[model samples]
Target: MPVPSAPGGAAGPATPPAPHITRRGLALAGLATAQFMVVLDSSIVNVALPSIRRGLDLTPAQLSWVVDGYLVAFAGLLLLGGRLADVFGRRAVLLGGLTAFAAASALCALAPNGPVLVGARIAQGAAGAVMAPAALSIVMTLFPDGPDRARALGVWGGVSGAGGIAGVLLGGVLSQTLGWPWIFVINVPVALAVGAVVLVSVRPFPAAGGSFDIAGAVTVTLAMAGLALGVVMGSDAGWTAPVTPAALVLGLAALAAFVALERRAARPLVPLRVLARPRLAVANTIMLLLGATAAGLFYFLPQYQQNVLGMSPLTTSLTQLPIALTITAGGLLAPRVAAVLGVRLALTTALAWLAVGLAWLARADPHARFLDGLLGPFLLIGAGLGTAFVYVTTLAVAGSAPGETGLVSGLVNTARQMGGAVGLAALVALATATGTPAGTGTPAGHQPNLTAAFLGAAALAATALLLSLTSALHHPAPTAASPLLPGQRTST
Candidate 1:
């Protein structure tokens, strides 16, 4: 089969290429698998946290590190990874990242101590940063048409949305039946298999030549790590702690330095011009808020199930099916909704749904029933999240130059990860500060803290809604001539 030419005839192949299982379809598959793995890792360890804590003899802070390590590395390195993919070949970087991720997963499964486990988690996250951008770039390159790309993205979004819920369910089942290690162990074979598929199916695209921005990379990485660590530690140590204040200060300083460096660097990690676009900037802000709100809700929901509802880990995981299934359903339906309602209308509606869902969750009590109180809210949350993801993602990627697609995608995803880390930390801090005892393994008192967390999440969702509304009103719809990276290319 002949390879399809890239946009503007800057490629090595001809048009009307013979379809061998359609390049678009295969590209979508590869991207979806990457997204699934990344999303799955996010919460897969939650159900096994107790087992891990017991087996590793971890303190609460150490246990938190198991999750935090991954977020820090993944979020910190994402921009660099995306630039690397653009400089090198996306396929090469993707396969390498997959191999590294598989090895790291194996190491995690074999870890004998908390430190080792945390280190392995960090390696896995770094590999994820590399893999994610390459995967999205493959999709962007393969599906150049608007309609085709939209459809492919809907499937991609569905996989990502479903993967989060599936992680909890799979983790619960694996931990109960096999052991916590299996949760990590399972990634090895899956990663290897996906690596093989990516190697075989993805065609080589031309590399965009550029030197890595080492200074920008270092500063941004430190900034992200500092910010994430500050929030995570603040939850346990109190916001007034010297360590928390120091971390926040250091993070802010580093970020400011990064901005200054980018303004001067010949090849910046993230071009400052890209950030100048109102639509992209606003969209990313909304993405960050939505991410934080979603993570906060997912993190605490299991606590309510296990502590308040008296559910087993397995049952708690099962109860999240309403969220998983609805997210998948909504993701699959998002493109159609976007087509019918337009991006602005769809986005506004989704945000409204999220607000309502969060408010409903805030009303939960110790006596709340699953069907009446939890199920509907979960379903609504999932649906709203699913729809919002499509719009936000589309806006993030829509008008970028070909060379900058990976960077744009990586930045958007990085925002999501950072948001999740900060959001989770903030909610936990609120629970701790309000002196609302998060039930010492009891039923009655646990619900109030969780409810408070959900209320905080609602406020975050409202913030996102406000931003989305402003973006819709002020920014015009992006056209094909617009650069994918913000301000990187001007309208023709």
Candidate 2:
């Protein structure tokens, strides 16, 4: 009898078998853990904010820094971090980032004052920047096949969506029972465990050989920092103030210079060609708007629960559970919806839902009941946000060139972070200018300002809806035939 063909129809003698360990499974676990950690940090401190403010004697401006510091650093350095992951080994970058994040979390827990806490938060953001790209990139490498990759990405999305809501609930429980410091302290153990798993299980991929774009990184970081600082300060000081304008001008100039550098550099921090892609540009814009709305909602929801509804920290956390649960469900369903409806239609529907939710929220009054007024809107926002994220992420990275995925993902996230910073700043300013709190001890004039802020959030959601619609209506350019194997092109 003729010799039976070896597996995969090899004519020559079969090569020696590779290792038995399943690297893809290990990588997916590590990446999901990293993403969960990053997303958790975004909302973990929110429930603890009042405690932190009192403990640290933080002014409103300084309190904003606690959040802004982390956001600015994370957003500013993300592009650089992604580039480093590509140039270095992703595994090494991930390990280093986790270490840095753990160290920073310890510092935050031990912080003596507002400045120290702010500094630690900034360090945490920088650490997040380093890890996030590597985590996503590992997923890409682990699941090179399209269907498997989509499933992995869906799981990742679900983790991130669920993590945001989980953070608030977890923070409330930890802060009420343990203390605010426990929130930060809790991360250390988790990081250590995940780090060990990654070190043992993740197989390193070949690094992209290239020189680090230090100058480009510095300029972009400076640009983001300056712009964020300018916005934060402009909220307090009039935008026409010399310092505010100066910071804004300087930030714009630095950003323009970074763009020029990117176009010229052989190994650009962010390739100009990638940004020039229409689909990526539109998706990123939508991501920015969606991020703004999401961040604003998170920022204000607690205010509604505690200030208006007279809920305690624990009660407030429980109240948010509906939104969180819905978001998790929406994330799991988003991929299926996209496969059935196409990316554009799904995203448009999601955005429309978000707009409706925000509009309902804008109608909230001091007399509004939780079940009647708040629950439906919160659920709508959460579901819409989950679906929108799925579409935006898919479009942002679709058909990206080899080794550029990290950069693309980082840019998308950066836009998101920056949008949150800008949106919050604008909302704060509007709130400051609006009506006072009802039944103040002094007089009607002393009432708290909340109407404008909620209105601003509604406007943000409306803007996001418009952007999503525009994206859906825009026709995608024709592309070359896909190289996917026959029978693999069927929609999920």
Candidate 3:
């Protein structure tokens, strides 16, 4: 539409190209901010759970629902949400999602009962599911497959993860100083501010126009909701409870139906071919384990520090600064490690690091000190989380077809959310069974309960490590013609 470049690649030797690149960079900043806020919600409420429980008269199990409920809706709707972004336009979807999320946060803040708070959390999660993939898809749309895209993703991934750890620390300060309601109230201003920036900076992406898959969306959403409910209630209501079995059966049946529908749908929500890829399958499984273990550890760690150790919320939050910093460092180094060691080897090493950290924490004694007992494990976990998230996400979308990027992003995130929901449910049950639900008991009894949960998380990491080793045996032979994984600096 404009003049061609002159001989020296100057734009007609007078007018420069439109400031498209700068616009893209600005857009990336807006998207990354939205992503950071979405991820922060997943953990920010954790430290506030005790305050909410006291204010609203919530049981320990009900408190778990506040976090898990968000996860359930997010995981369930992610695929459909991604598709909708393609249909509705990325900027439109993201703005809409941010609006909904902000409103939900207000709802959560104003709720006087546990049920209302949990419901609001679910609304926030669903909106986040829409926002996250749409935001990332915008990244892919704006940045070409090169160093630019890679760098943007690196910043995106790092900020997304740092939000999770930072939430624990921030939650403590807000709950301690401003009261628990401030945690949710804080989201309103941030979300609105980010939305305003995005509106002004980011242009709308053309919709990946298609007929919506109504049946697929409905069934899968129902399946994930049922599964999350079953998992949560399975522990609380006992495995043999009639409702638990019914929910489990209903969830599985709906899942089967969703699969059957997808196989025949004219425009499927998730293509079977994508799911069948061997490398993607393994990578997602590893992500699931990593997500689950991390969620479990975060869930219990604060309870131990506050309940057993009698630490104030501010002090407890400060303890996690080391984790946040190390995760940032780990993210910076992940690309280099992947270039040198290959994806499988690098991921395995990261998993091993996580396992070591968890095992170290598992050895805690009844009267342990934080510096001697917890700091080392937190460092290891942060490093592992930082590196694993980068590489695993790269692997998940490595070979995707052009239009399928949003779908894969949604699937990858769904794995993490589902893993967190299920893992937290299981660990919550374990802690209850071990002793009085995350050490809400005598000081002497607290350490053992937390130790059991930490060991369980360690075991999950080890399992992922074992899977990574098995996958290494099946690596394809590298050749001169082989393609490097997407955006990797090398062919390793």
Candidate 4:
């Protein structure tokens, strides 16, 4: 029998709610494993692109589809997935998504051609969209509703943050030692295992009774799809392309309508009050900036290392190992850092690292030494990115009402996805705008090319920093926006 407790109690096992996963050790393992598999798929296929292309007889454009398809579907439907998890039941939806994800992985592994692979990846990404937010929301329920949750989130961030880098490493090992298909095949067993664990370990979440906002779901899904399409197509088709502007307008209009409709809906997919919270708002905005600048950082750095500095692809990939490790280290350090330097200062310092690091990288000369020139900024970037992502994510979810976890989680994630697409697209355009002259020296042309992009990324980080200098990040006492830190107590 369930132990009856006061609403919003802050005790150990019943932090906010009684999590059947015990609100402790083994449950966290289940959540983290599920998180890893969902996040790993985002980048696992990148290293296998060449092999996939040859094996599937895919055109460059078709190969691009393999990635873009997944991204669009994942980013577009995240909020819907989150809402479903919260409204229906987290455990049920999570298990369902894991099952679908494993099945999709199987389809991807066995795909015979480009179309099949693209379709399977899209399905896989959609399943991930469902799984990611639900798993995260469950994390919220698993820890005590105070400093414990904050610290646990740090661990969660470390595992989640490392997924992309881990994918690159794993993809290389699996694809080379086995085949390109192994990248997806590996997920099948992992997802199945995660699913089995959740089923056996987790107690069912009661459906939060609510009227289905079917109309709201449709509008937002279309809105996100349109916006993602605009950004994704803007690079290839030109920003002025008919499809791009049309999609943008459609998305913006639908978004506006969705907001207006939500304000009046009996049960909105996302409540308007949640959007009104300053801390949540700024946190998600910072998350967007983090994702954008990070996209530019990763997109350009490896190119500079290989093309300008003359390093082997294998060597360049291996070099990033330090960055990946540093990222995980930073994630683990975030709660401690936030404890010492208040959240705002910590976040500001993290952004400063990005601005300063990227700005430093802009001065990279053609003959620059790897250890002295690149390693510092890479470490700084890795740590800064690690810290920023963890803190921003924590703040993003800090002040959620009982049933709003999935909504907020989805919102922050959607911001990250869209930001990355937009950031990388804009940077690519800037890099390509001034085409390399036929006789330009490698040093002269490549140096400036990479420098300009790095400087732009620095400027973007700086802008975000400037924007971050506000009251939202500061909380001498926990506000309704953020009352879940160690010393903090939840107010009902």
Best by lDDT: 3
The better-scoring model by TM-score among 1 and 3 is: 3
lDDT of 4 by residue, 1-492 (tens): 000001111111224545466435666777788878776776666556656766787643355557656655676566667667767888898899999999999999999988899899879878877887778777776666678787777667657666757775776677667888999999988888887777777788877755567677668766765775665557546789899899889989988988889999987766788777887778777877776677666656655776677764455566777777777778667777877776667778888997898898889898988789888988877787777776676666675665554466567767776566556555654554433543566433322256777887888888888867877755333446544444322111
Which 10 residues in a row give candidate 3 its minimum summed lDDT? 1-10
Per-candidate clashes, comma-separated:
7, 4, 0, 1
Largest TM-score belongs to which candidate? 3
Q: lDDT scores for all predictions?
A: 0.72, 0.70, 0.73, 0.69
Q: Give me the runs in candidate 1 sitting further than 4 Å from their true place.
A: 1-32, 50-61, 139-158, 198-209, 396-407, 435-448, 471-473, 480-492
How many angstroms is residue 47 displaced in model 3 relative to the true structure, after the best TM-score fit?
A: 2.3
Q: How does model 2 fare in lDDT? A: 0.70
Cα misplacement distance, residue 467 of candidate 1 (Å)? 2.3
What ranges in model 3 sit over 4 Å off?
Answer: 1-26, 144-151, 203-208, 398-406, 437-448, 477-492
Q: What is the Å distance of residue 169 in model 1 from its true position?
A: 2.6
Candidate 3 vs candidate 4: the TM-score winner is 3
- TM-score for candidate 2, residues paired by index: 0.85
Each candidate: RMSD:
6.0, 7.9, 7.1, 6.5
108-210 in candidate 2: lDDT tens per residue?
Answer: 9999999999999999988988888777666665664567767887688667766777797987888778888999998999899889888777766557667
